[model samples]
Each structure stands twice: as C-alpha cells, then as structure tokens.
Target: MVSQPMPLLNGEPHVGVFIKTASHQVVEVLGAAGLAFGVIDGEHAPIDRSVLDTMLLAGYACRLPLLVRVADGSGPAISSVLDMGAAGIVVPHVDCPEYARQVVAHAKFAGGRRGLSTSPRYAGYGSMSMHEAVCSGDETAVICQIEDPEGVQNAQLIAQVEGVDALFIGPLDLAHSLGADSVREPVVREACEHIARAACGAGKAAAIFLSDPSDKAYYQELGVTLFIIGSDQSMMRQGTRALSSA
Candidate 1:
C-alpha cells in the first residue's frame, strides 16, 4: 500500500515509463523524463545481478522509486529481489487466489518470514532502525500481472488478495492469449477493459501495459494509476528517430 502510485489511488494519476536499458545508463536518464517512477524489468530484459545491484544503487541515488518485475515466482527469484530492497514487485502470470496469497506472503516478513539481512542496500545498509525496515518490508507491494485469458477471467479474485495492491495487464501476453501477436487487437483491449473494471470494483489499482506517451487519456478513462510508458530501448530509438525525421 505504501508503494502504490498514490495519484491513481487518491484520485489523481501519474504517468510513468518502463526502463529496459542497461542498468547503469538508464538510472540517470530515467528520472530526467519527468515521470513518477520506473520498472526495471529484469524478467524480460537481460540484466545480471552484479549490474542490477549497481543499477538499483544509482536508481536510489537519483531518487526514483523502482519496481522490479521478477522473472519468476520461485523462492530465490522473487525473494532475492525483495531482500535486495526493491520498492515493489511485479509478479507475472499470477492466475489463482493461492498464487496471489503466496505473492503477498513472500513479500512480507511477518506474513511469510522472508530472510533478512541488515547490510543490504534496501535498508540503507543498516542505517534504518529494525522496526522501520520491518515495516517497510511488510508493506511493500506484490503487484499481480494478469497477462493471460485465464488470469483475466479470475482478475477480481486475484485483486481481492489481502496484499495485492494492483492488477497489471500485460498487453503482449494478453494478445497472445487471445490468439494474436499484436496488442492493438480488439480482443486484448476488451479483456484489459474487463480487468480494469474488476480492479476498480475490488478497490485495487489497475496498471496498463502500454507505454505510449500519448495514451494518457485512454488509461485515465479506465482508472489506471500506474503507467509503464515505454521501454528504454524504445526511448533510445525514438530519440534518434525523431532527430533524423526532423
């Protein structure tokens, strides 16, 4: 709850972007874009642990609240990122209520008993009081990614999970699940709309997977608070493309 994009929850909306660039280079550029926050997508992007540690450090230095999309739900895959101090976790393909419950438990210490270490960067390297760190760890989000047809069918139950603050729709996955390769198809859009309505009704935020800078109004109409605008690779290409086209 603490890590939610407050704009979406409190009746305002923040437009954010996704970072798929090298961890080092993206950190400085990420904050300069005038967006709220960024997701360092370790799940889809190829990034190493050593580089990730550095990237997160630089991200913290720049004061960008980061959400790391965990590649999997396994103990090491998810727990290691939380232990390393990611402010939020975007878990993909969470279809059932038990999966939703487990995501929360893994993110929370009292709820799931994740191992803790004082010297990690997430705790400011032991600068934070034990109580404060514990509170932070417990409250950090475990966002569910409703990416498939099955997940969309059960989006409401997934959103209602005790610690699931939001349900994020992955456009590509949704499209694929709908027997298409492109997200612009009507079937995927319709399903996403269904997920959005379910999230709003359940008192949880909905995150749109589109990263287009021009899609603000579209997401707003659906009550989406968290916006992953564009990937780092896309930004780099667009920047260069714009210059040439100009």
Candidate 2:
C-alpha cells in the first residue's frame, strides 16, 4: 500500500449474483444493464483466459468495475487477474491479516513487483504506456472475504491491512461454519453486523451479499455500501418462475 495519498474511486455499490457460468455475451449484457461490478467466478465457475478477456473488455466498455473472486487467495490466478486488467480483485475465504497481506502483494505492482507485462489485455494490449499502467495499479481495489469463524475473529486486522479496500462477509459460509443456516438466520445476521462494525472501525468498507431488493437500502443505511445483492442465476430463476406461472 502506498503511503502517498491516492484518490480511491468507489463506483456505485452494487448487489449482483455469483455468475457461475462463463457466458461472455451474458456477462456483457448484465453489466451494461447495471451492476457496479461483477465478481468473475474463478472460485466456482469455469473462467478461462478467453472468457475473462471478453468479460474484461465488456466491463471496460461499460465503465463497470470487474473483479475476479478467487476461490483460493494468493496464487497463480490472482496474479493473472491483475495482469489481465481487472478493476480489482475479491479474494474469498480470507482468514487473517496474513491472508490480506498476500492479497495486496498479488494485486499491487508497487511493492509486489508483479512482473510488468505490456501488450496485455489489461494494459490495452500495448495501448497504454508502461509507466502509466503501473501508476493506475496503485489505485486498484483489493477486497478480501471474511467468511470462516477464524476470519470473523480476525476481521479487524484483515480490514486494517494497508491495501485492503473492503472486507466482504460471506453470510452463508460463515453461518455454515458457525453451525447455522445462512439465509434469514439470526446468528448469521449478527455475525454480519459484527464484521461490518469491525470493518468500519478499521476504516475499511464493508461488503455483504444481500439477496433481496428491499433489504438493499437497509444495509446502505447501516453504512455498508458494497453489496452483492442479487445474481444472474437468481434473476433467471425468478424470471422462469414468472414465465411458468404465466
């Protein structure tokens, strides 16, 4: 993280679904419609170089921030996303500050020295000057997930990590880890609030997954701005239900 003050750009807080399949056209269409960002599913979905390139192109054209949610944080793929020109990254299953530090290292080119690659999709395929590209990297976002019990315990330290932009809470995973159902569970809700408060205390943004539209504004009121409220799959399921009824 650069000690030098850098202007962080927070795009609209969006709620989106876990895009589990690689469909470039669908990814492009949904983003164009509206979604502050899309977490390209590197964790559960089949995302390859070609699909990711297309998705990144779509996000770039729409001016929507695109993030890759890595199933495992800090490895080969995380480095690839930064190099591919993703707006930022969301590392899932982060358990501590050590994990957060690794996330920053892989996402940033400053101290991490993530090998300079020009003529890459992220660098506009050699359109951007090497110096300029490196500079943009400094402002790139790095979101870490706090899902497991250990992660929630260390949520503050994780958020306090220098380059961490947000601490996202995976309600379901967290609830499961705590031996409770995720959706509409009182235990999960409390845990979510706990993580949010710690993130607020640590001076990092709090991101949560919200499934219902009515609940979206509530979290924003609670000072949680980054919300993944719905997903493409859920929307499709809702639509299919309507269609079947009709």
Candidate 3:
C-alpha cells in the first residue's frame, strides 16, 4: 500500500475552506477551485454522523483532505472521525500542554489509547494489515485550538507536545478572552503573534481562521501557513450578493 502525501506537510502555504452545509457539491466545487483542504465545521454546525459520512465520502471522491473540528475533545469523538477517514482532527479549546497531549493520544495510536478497528472505512475495510493501519493512524494530523488566554499562555508547551502537528488560533474566542472588541484588536493580534512564534519555534504548523482573505498576508508574515477562510455558506451568500449587485 502506497502512503498518501499530507498536503499540509509540503512546506507550501495551504488554504482551506470551511464546510458547514451537508451538500457534497460544496466539497467538489471547493476541490475544483484549487483549495488545499476542507474543514467540516462539526463544532458549531449541526453535523451528525450520517451527514459527516456523506461529507467524508464526498471528500474521498474529490481527493480533498477533510479535517473535522470535533465538537469536543474526547477519546471517542476523535477516534470516531479518524475511523471514518477524516484526513485529520481539529480539537477545540486545548488550554494546556496536557490537553494538547490528550488530543494527540485520542487521535493517534502511538502511545495513545484510541480504540482500534480494522473494519472502519479508513482501514480499507480490513484490506490493510494491522501495521499499515497503525501507521496510517499515526500519520493522521492532530491540530489543537488555542482559544483561551490560558491556551495562549501555554502555547509554547502545547506546540512542543509530541504528535501534535499544528496549532490553530481561534481569533474570535481569543479576542473575547482578551476583552477585545474584535479579532483585529491589537491585543488579540499580539497573542496570535506569540502563538505563531511558539509554533514556529517548535517546528510545527501554525493555522488560523480568517474571514477576510486580505488578512492572509498579515498572518503569513507571522509564520502561519494554514488559513481556513470562510465557509461554503458564506461564499455562496457573498457570491450571490455580488451577482445581484452586478
């Protein structure tokens, strides 16, 4: 079995779109549009297992890496998405190094207690050997979200955690945690810069959610390489409004 390449590991800036709708067409359209990946918004959206399975299938058909932002960081929650073949798992509100470590434990099998099963879709329905399955599981990207002030304070240690591939900054939550009026507040920006620096120091990928595409340059300068910008629904709404105005 040939190993699949992880796009985020390619040393190029990867742009990903968030998917909140249950439509498979969104996945195909985004993939065709040259987006590097899709982040299924299970954290805020009402995405159940049935919908998630369909979206995962759509991602497979489009050859698009789909990372699921689990509603909460739990062993069962992380294991379920990995078993269903999510390219990676994005755990929310990882406040400390221990929490980041726990996220890795739940997503990866090496020194992890993630329940194993060869019959899952990711295992090729038992076509793969146990070793192959374990290897693949180990490769699954584990991203931890640093949303709170505590998370920002512990960002360096969190980035240093083994098996934690990336650090994702939650702009809005970070702003709220800093008592800022908006994500663009200078305080929030400083915190983001600090987190980005920590991630870079640890040689880990740094990611953020930016609604405005123009903000990409600013974050990129701070050593962030992964940008999750806008959702399918937002894109459709903006496109429709632009067409109507035109």
- The TM-score leader among the candidates is 3
Instruction: Superpose all Cα atoms of candidate 3 onto the true structure and report the RMSD in Å to 1 decimal.
Output: 1.4
Clashes within 3 Å, all models in order: 2, 5, 0
Task: Give lDDT tens digits, candidate 1, residues 1-246.
Answer: 122222334446766667776666677777766667778888888887777777776666666767889887766777777666666789999888888888887777776757766556666678777776677676666789998888998999998888888889888889887898778788988898999888889999888767666766887798887778777788889999999999
Q: State TM-scores per candidate.
A: 0.91, 0.90, 0.96
Better of 1 and 3 by TM-score: 3
Expressed as tens digits, the lDDT of each residue in 175-211 for candidate 3 is: 9888999988899999999999999999999999999
Query: Best by lDDT, which number?
Result: 3
Rank the models by lDDT, top first: 3, 1, 2
Q: Model 2, range 116-186, lDDT digits (tens) per residue?
A: 76666666667777787677665677888888889988888888999889888788788789899555788
After superposition, candidate 1 runs with Cα above 4 Å error: 1-11
lDDT of 3 at 38: 89
Candidate 2, superposed: residue stretches over 4 Å from native: 1-12
Error of 2 at 222 (Å): 2.2
CA RMSD (A), model 2: 3.7
Instruction: Tell me how candidate 2 scores on lDDT.
Output: 0.74
